[model samples]
Target: MFVDSRRREGAAAFRHIFHVQMDGATSDRESPLMKYNYVALILGVLLILLVVLGNILVCVSVLTERSLQTATNYFIISMSAADLLLALLVLPLFAYSEFLGGKWTLGMTLCDALMTMDVMLCTASIFNLCAISVDRCIAVLVPLKYNQNQFSSRQLGLIAATWVLSLGVASPVIFGMNQVADRDLSTCKLEDDRFVVYSSVCSFFVPCPIMLLLYFWMFWGLRRRRSRTPLKDPCHRRSFCSTLVLALCHAKSLTDSVSDGEARTQRREGQRNRPKTVMRSRKASRVSRRERKAMKVLPVVVGAFLACWTPFFVVHVTKVFCGWCTVSPTLISVVTWLGYVNSAVNPVIYTAFNTAFRNVFHKILSRWM
Candidate 1:
């Protein structure tokens, strides 16, 4: 009987040990999840800060520097403002939701507001980029007529229209047209397929194609210019030969004392002005080189925009169209954050491409330092 009792005790002990082991395993799984949550929280905060600061710097630099206050840079300023709005109004809420494991504690009205702002600001940003591409294309293709004054008013009108259109795209939510009424209150998303399609087309599909076409035309113009450059070399050589012959004739006249007194004075004056003319030509060439470099950097901006936003938009469209396809929440979060990262990247691209922005940024930084 005692042996049987001892055996029962051992069995109970084994069961207790098994329970303890299972608990430990569960805790082990949870620890990594908790660690991940902490990491995500930290990263999200940093991203918000980065986006805010970078865009603010861009706006301030443009506003303060007269050189950057041109018509082309007004589009850039608008882009920065859109990004700043996104970082301020959208990102904090997103970060909070992310930290809470995608559960939005914010109310439904705020949820709708957040989603509206998200769609509106992002759409505006993309449209601003499209405007920039169009502006650059015109500047390259029609240099003589690309006056900033002629475009300034039109650009302002276009920027205003861009926001109006963005608001129109996002207006359905405010009117209760496309809402996920029965969706989980813990999560806020545009669940209506029609609204998704509309928003996607307005924000990405239409604008992306237009941007691509403008860039293609711009590059085609550039290639034509480059190919014709060699042809211009022969004309330049002929002009040089003509100028040399004229100079030789003038020298012969001077040597033969066939030139009048007034002519000798005129020749001396021309010799004195030649160095100044060469200096002006060299300065103009340098300016042209800088403009070309800026032009080259623009494609990089467009390419970066495409790369950063494509995956998010692709997954978004797929989710809307494929009802049965399941996507992990983590994946959605990653792609959403990826899109936000573009806001941070933009000012960096501006600083890299445009020397004026870089100089203004340095001046701003120096004041603080």
Candidate 2:
């Protein structure tokens, strides 16, 4: 849905797009904009396919793979469901409208429904990420109570709350708030300025910081615990083994009536081999910083979400208050599609580091291949 020049209500044609021409207003097939639309249409179709495939893999992997059946992965499955629904329920019409130059050919009913689902699902995605962060924080700060990856009532409650709160945020659209007297019939977008602002705050502003802080606390706790109790030294164990081997060699020499000279040679060999054992022990005990990097899916996921969505809410809220400011239609469509890209991007980036999901994904995909 898009907003018109009058700044009145718009519906599901990505509603915040302001100053778009009416339907069939631009029919120049050979024009640059038409060529651009063609490219966008192709890309949009690929994006939909990717989102569907990737999210389906996530859901199936979590359901079918025993290793992925954990509290954290359940949250991921919920998040993937949101992205998958966005692709199935929302993006086709969104891309069609973009091709139509922001004209909402779909009836007002579908437009309203699409707009509601769009807000709810996008917000639900953010909420699920926040929930995952919260779950990780709990596992870090209170390990014994977390039950080592059990899906408890608390996790269920969090997932339920995520959807319910998202619905609450978007319920106003369902209540005919977009049916204003001066609404544009040609374009569909969000109708109420207050709703745009409210949804923006609820979806992005509130949850993003919570995710960031929770991840920060989790890392801090992990580092602090590791610092309090350093890892055991390996040199002591290696030295004991060396002495036992040397004593055994000497005892065998005595049993064979071997001379002290030959026993001293074996003892000297043990002393010479001690440095290699110490080096091997040290290498085995060394910790890599990549271990910390491997656990950084939190930052990557949250950062991608924010990178994709921040522009959208920022533009929407800015358009609400700064009516005099001139934002290009191209910019609006770019940001809107950027949000759509997030649905595809999240499933890929979020599960990229998860070995269980990757293994299951390979197993499922291998059957088709």
Most TM-score-accurate candidate: 1
Residue 275 displacement in candidate 1 (angstroms): 18
What digit string (tens of lDDT, one per residue) describes model 1 on residues 1-369? 999999999999999999999999999988757744666688888988988988899889878888777677788888889989998999888888877778777788898898899999989989988888877777667654564354466688878988898899888877775466577776888867788888899899999999999888877876676566555443333443454455445655674555576566756655556444544434434433444666777777778888889888899999988989998888898899899899899889988877788899999999978
Q: Model 2, poorest ten-residue lDDT window?
A: 282-291
Model 2's alpha-carbon lDDT is: 0.78
Backbone clashes, candidate 2: 13
> Pairing residues by index, what is the TM-score of model 1?
0.76
**lDDT per residue (tens digit) for residues 50-114 in model 2:** 99998998888889888677787799889999998999989888888877767787799989998
Q: Which ranges of candidate 1 are over 4 A from the true structure?
A: 1-36, 148-151, 229-291
Candidate 2 Cα outliers beyond 4 Å, as residue runs: 1-36, 233-294
How big is the positional error of residue 329 in model 1, measured in Å on the Cα after superposition? 0.9
